[model samples]
Target: MAHTTERPVREREDASIGELLSAVTSDAQKLFRQEIELAKAEVREEATKAGKAAGMYGGAGFAGYMTALFASLAIVFALANVMDWGWAALIVTAVWAVAALVLYMMGRSRMREVSPKPERTVQTLKEDAEWARHPTR
Candidate 1:
């Protein structure tokens, strides 16, 4: 006669495929949150770089505008001195002024194109806040 031992098999709920997939998705979400937090500094740095680039572009445009204004004035003065014709100089100066105004407006519109609003980042932050308020199980 041999002694026999009885043991009950353990039933693991997480052994099913669905349970495993859910566990993986939950862990992924947590990891995504942590990654987002880690990337905040990088995002801030990139934003600063973008802002600096925009400012440089703006300054370059303003400089070009002022240069055009002064050049037009210089042309008027030169024409007046050399040609000894006040009306011709005045007419040329007025044309230059109008051209400069048009160019300046165009430059302003171009600058507006690169302006940053941070709308996407703001929306992401809002979504993250909402998730934090009501996290998944």
Candidate 2:
């Protein structure tokens, strides 16, 4: 006995080609707008993080400045008991300068952690483009 084979058929378009084109164009425009918005939001979030880090660095700078000023007087007084007050004051000032340098470096490292690139948005946009190119998949 011979068996008949059946196959599934693709659906036909109900609208005219121009209408379809128009619809597709509208959808594409909307998609791009949404992508732009997503990029903006992502960048804004990253920028906010960067701003916070910058503010932290500024605070460190202020603190370091204040510490240096007060520490200078303390160093001079503490050194008075040592061999020569002048020598002690100089040594203490050097130590305070080194401490400030360390704090500046720490602040720099912290700020470096914050990247300006909208990495997540870039990744999503790439995926969206890939899907747009091969939507049937």
Candidate 3:
């Protein structure tokens, strides 16, 4: 019969509570970093989407502006013969401007809310780094 040397006591003797806790914390920090990386990628993707949306909105706004310009010109020409509705062109231009402003503000506000995950991920990683530097254990 051959006896195998299984030294479980040596393994337990070398690992202190502090070391174990540190290892766990280190692993947690690594996980947090991975999450942060994922968040950063997500932010990039969202930024690209926002950029494309902004571009489309810009194109649409330009088209709307051109349409409004032409329509106002036509209204002015049609109203030139009638003094009762000469201010209709000005009203049309004003309404178009207000509508464009509202759309732009709404788009800007929505884009602002898109990248919060990256900021939260960064905050979590910083907190994990701080904990690693001065662990309670």
lDDT tens per residue, model 1, 46-88: 5776676566657656765775577756777778776766775
Candidate 1 local lDDT, residue 124: 68
TM-score quality measure for candidate 1: 0.43
Note the Cα lDDT for every prediction shown.
Answer: 0.62, 0.76, 0.71
Best by lDDT: 2
Ranking by TM-score: 2, 3, 1
Q: Candidate 1 — which pairs collide?
A: none
lDDT (tens digit, per residue) of candidate 3 on 1-137: 98843334336577777766666666777796788687878788878868866775786588668868787788777876665565867766786777777767766776775664567667767886788698674
Better of 1 and 2 by lDDT: 2
Itemize residue pairs with steric clashes in candidate 2: none
TM-score, per-candidate, Cα-based: 0.43, 0.77, 0.56
Model 1 scores a C-alpha lDDT of 0.62
Model 3: runs farther than 4 Å from truth? 1-36, 45-49, 56-60, 84-88, 114-117
Candidate 2: misplaced stretches above 4 Å? 1-12
